[model samples]
Target chain A: MNELKELGEFGLIDLIKQDTINDHSSVVVGIGDDAAVLLPTPRQLQLLTTDMLVESVHFKLTTTTPWQLGYKAIAVNLSDIAAMGGVPRHAVVSLALPQSTPAEFVTNLYKGMKEICRAFGVNIVGGDTVSSPHGLVINVTVAGEVEPANLVCRSGARPGDVVAVTGNLGSSAAGLDLLTAGEWEDFDFAWPLVTAHLTPRPQVKLGPVLAAAGATSMDDISDGLASEAHEIAKASQVGIKLYAKQIPLAPELAEAAGQLNKQALDYALFGGEDFQLVFTMEPGNYEALLAAYLDLPVVKVGEVVDADEGVTLVDEDGQAQKLEARGFNHFRQEE
Target chain B: MNELKELGEFGLIDLIKQDTINDHSSVVVGIGDDAAVLLPTPRQLQLLTTDMLVESVHFKLTTTTPWQLGYKAIAVNLSDIAAMGGVPRHAVVSLALPQSTPAEFVTNLYKGMKEICRAFGVNIVGGDTVSSPHGLVINVTVAGEVEPANLVCRSGARPGDVVAVTGNLGSSAAGLDLLTAGEWEDFDFAWPLVTAHLTPRPQVKLGPVLAAAGATSMDDISDGLASEAHEIAKASQVGIKLYAKQIPLAPELAEAAGQLNKQALDYALFGGEDFQLVFTMEPGNYEALLAAYLDLPVVKVGEVVDADEGVTLVDEDGQAQKLEARGFNHFRQEE
Candidate 1:
């Protein structure tokens, strides 16, 4: 959760996206696709999203290898496209490196990027490599295609929709916690958390299916669940209340959190960079649309409500507390 | 020239772009758009290019205003599209700002970007903003379109092609000089150089014209005329010799260079950040395709030759000297 304070990754996206950029006719959606979708032509819709990763702030070289760094950079962008019900096609990388960086590190970074791109059937098309005076800076832009009907946006969650997630969350955040603490001596217990943090699998396949199945809204949970739920609420003009007990957390992350004297719910709610998809759909639509795809580990965590109710979370005690867009503190309401 | 030594920008693009990326069916061009072109489909070719600008390395806030920084960021990406003979339609910005950065800076930056986007008929479609631990980093990915037949690439320069530039050179480099040195007492002489450095216009219109005119090879003169010439020669399997007297220099830049006690040719040869298009086409093709578009200020400054002749430059004295991919040195041959 402290990393959320330090990183400040997507916290300001909503504020920045509100600033008016030119509205062109070719643009089907602008800033508030806020998934960052840009469809050039109606017939040939291309989903475009970009993410910039800063060294030390977003990552540290001591813990993240150049290879993993490259892999995650692509993964984040791909996650955005998938959340929009699109298939990423090409990636253009803007890599700024210090002059002193070893040649081998860059090679490995691209290898990692290419490996992921190969898995997703995406091409590494064009890129610019410049010398940075400071730490490494990577900005990746992924271009994808989506059918107009299958396209999803953040501004579609409605009252009475089921608040659901595609997979277990917090493992990535727990993994990050484990990596930074480096106090977990048992390889057997700590390996999953470390791997999850290092290389979080994006729910690429489920996104389009969800859109086709008519999910009301979707978001790639890059900035923790509470922050993402806030974005969806603000965009959709609705309210979301997630259930603490219902929020799915991997057994590995839960076990590690217990050993580390941390709450798993804290990691799920506030720990960012969990690339799992959090979405909403009408409860009645699930039987025909998602029943066949039940193997996706899709779990209902809560329900949507009127905007007046506000985005809140129901703790185990049945107390609903308002969630701050900032760090999650269960006792923040008391404070 | 000192800034060139300090900034080391784009010096290693070739080595990095040379690394193998996946070859996919949809990727009409990969690493070597090396202007970074990605044609999604054969019929619907999309030229993709990305550039990352880092503080101190690319621009200093002390010298570049947020507005100018934003304008130049889009300008650089637009220039890449122009160089490829494509019409830029969309841009995705990845802006990393320090937590201390004022909200006003971000607004003005977007205002500048939007103003330029409006001018060029481009849209600011998507963006991601994150807190940077260090200096501001702006990465822009421009998506453009071109007829596959009219597309220009670095490897298209053939022997006997006339090497031409869209406009006067060295103004941008000279402008950077005036900004950093701050020794320019005369605003009349120094203003153009500073303006050129801060807000050099991209040759967006000329790119498609030159490509349509059957330009054999092309590249944005970003790194410098010498560095760009080497890329063309290396890609096209040809030699290029730029004529010093023929390389167009604006009177404003020439006067400023003289006042600073520096040679204009040095700025033209090695000073980077000029967004003009440097292209090549045969003399026979020029009269028919370009004669009508003569007002574009297209100047022939060099000639492509057999590869064994090498990428070189003819000094004013008629001394043919090899041009290094690195910084320029007139007396480098003397050593």
Candidate 2:
């Protein structure tokens, strides 16, 4: 654990540069410059998204490694691009680290980010590194390209659209529960849940697939299904009706929820950081999309309704209840 | 002053969105979307840069207002775009703030950033806001476009190229001195220097002008003239010879330096945060560049030399000495 001060800003940057590999053809210049130069793809609109993760607020260093933290930082920003039905191409990461941080931690952090970038075919272009008086801060800005015809925005969902999601929900929250309880190792079923919490994969491919299948509005579930559905509903001036039973939850998540003495449905509806795609499409296109993704874990869990109807959830008893957008808020007091 | 927790994250974002005015036609989608959609300019290369500023490290709130901090945040990132000879089109600002901060401070901060964005014809596109346990961290990512033919890089300098800078040096450092001394009000002549430190303008227009005028290589002087010159030399694999007497200094800066019992040349050579452009151009193109920028303050301060000659500063006494890069490093211990 070499102190960050011993490496200096330039030294840390050099270590990062040595590990970075640029594979994108659009990257005319990458790293070691004041600014990165990228060639634009003809006939494609560019997508840009930025996300910041602060220590103690976004993550606890005591429970997570620097590597996991770095991966999550890039993954969250990439998820934003995924939600836009765009193909991520380049990223710039700005890190504010305390002097007491170890040089090895910084190196591993880059390694974690690089792993995801390589998997997604994104290039690490340029960024700034500065010292913080306390705690670690990471900000990642991702740039991607999207064909105008395939682009999906949250404002396009119409009444009578079918709402669907990719993969299982609530697992990330359940995993977090196991980690917080220190019972992750006690149950073999908790491994998947813990991994989901630590390194949740972004639905980057599912976005484009759904976009081509006529997804009218799409958003990644970073703030849980209900909250994300609320965003789409508000943006499109429509209402959302989610079927509680239709929502998918992994067995591991169910087991973990049971261990925590909580209902799995609650986590599925309100637990954030799922990194799954929640999309809305016309009912006519739902069958075709499902058929196209038959091998994938795509589930139709809801339908878009008129704005006057309001966002709601229908339980097994056929009772409709108004749904509150109870998602994560940085400044909100935790219950 | 209102507590940041009272406003919450979404409330703060709404405040920022209300103050933001988009003027760029390239921005098809700005804030409120998962990602910003930008129309790519035809046949142009894209430029991207990110900069992070942390509290108590990059600045102190005691001496500066939130408005100035916000303005400086955007300005610094814009400077990186300017250094690349690109026209800034969009900017994303990520802020990590403590909950104890005032809502009014956040509002004023956005106003400051909006002020600069409006002046530069750049749009505020997308960003993220997160809570920090302590202190403030601001990260800005700027995207711009540049013509491939007019793009300039630091690796293009040649041995016979002339080294020149736009405007005077050391004024920003002198202003910082005045600010630290708490005598900024007593010296009328120090006001300009103080303002320079507070809000150094990015030479956005001059970069393209110099690029068109055949600048071989260029970089903005953020880490003092000597350090920036070394970067160009190392990148281009050439030695640089700076004429100490020819380095431009503001009259106010000289007076401030004298009052601090420091040589004006020392301040001009080693003082950081100048926010000026240091460029290298062919000797033949220097006359045309000067003619083109006749109204602007452009000065020839040095010349590129053979690598064997090393980086040197020739004194007025006709003696040359090696120039060590003595710029500020965030992790380096102060001497």
Which CAPRI quality tier does the interface of model 1 achieve?
Answer: incorrect
* Candidate with the greatest DockQ versus the true structure: 2
Q: What is the lDDT of residue A265 in candidate 2?
A: 87
Best by lDDT: 2
Q: A169-244, model 2: which lDDT tens digit per residue?
A: 9988888878788846878989988788888899887788888889999999888888998999999999999999
Q: Which stretches of candidate 2 lie over 4 Å from their true place?
A: none
Q: Which tens-of-lDDT digit does each residue in B1-335 have in candidate 1? A: 22211212122122222212223333322321101222343354666778788888788988988899989999998998888788887777777777556556766787778778778877665566666777889999877777767777788888988999988888889888888888665678888788889998999888888988889888898878998898789878899999998999989887888777899988988898888889889988876766686566888899999999998889889999988775422112212
Regions of candidate 1 where Cα sits further than 4 Å from its true position? A1-42, A317-319, A327-335, B1-43, B185-187, B317-319, B328-335
Model 2 DockQ vs. reference: 0.86
DockQ scores for all predicted structures? 0.18, 0.86
lDDT per model vs. reference: 0.75, 0.88
Worst 10 residues of 2 chain B by lDDT: B18-27
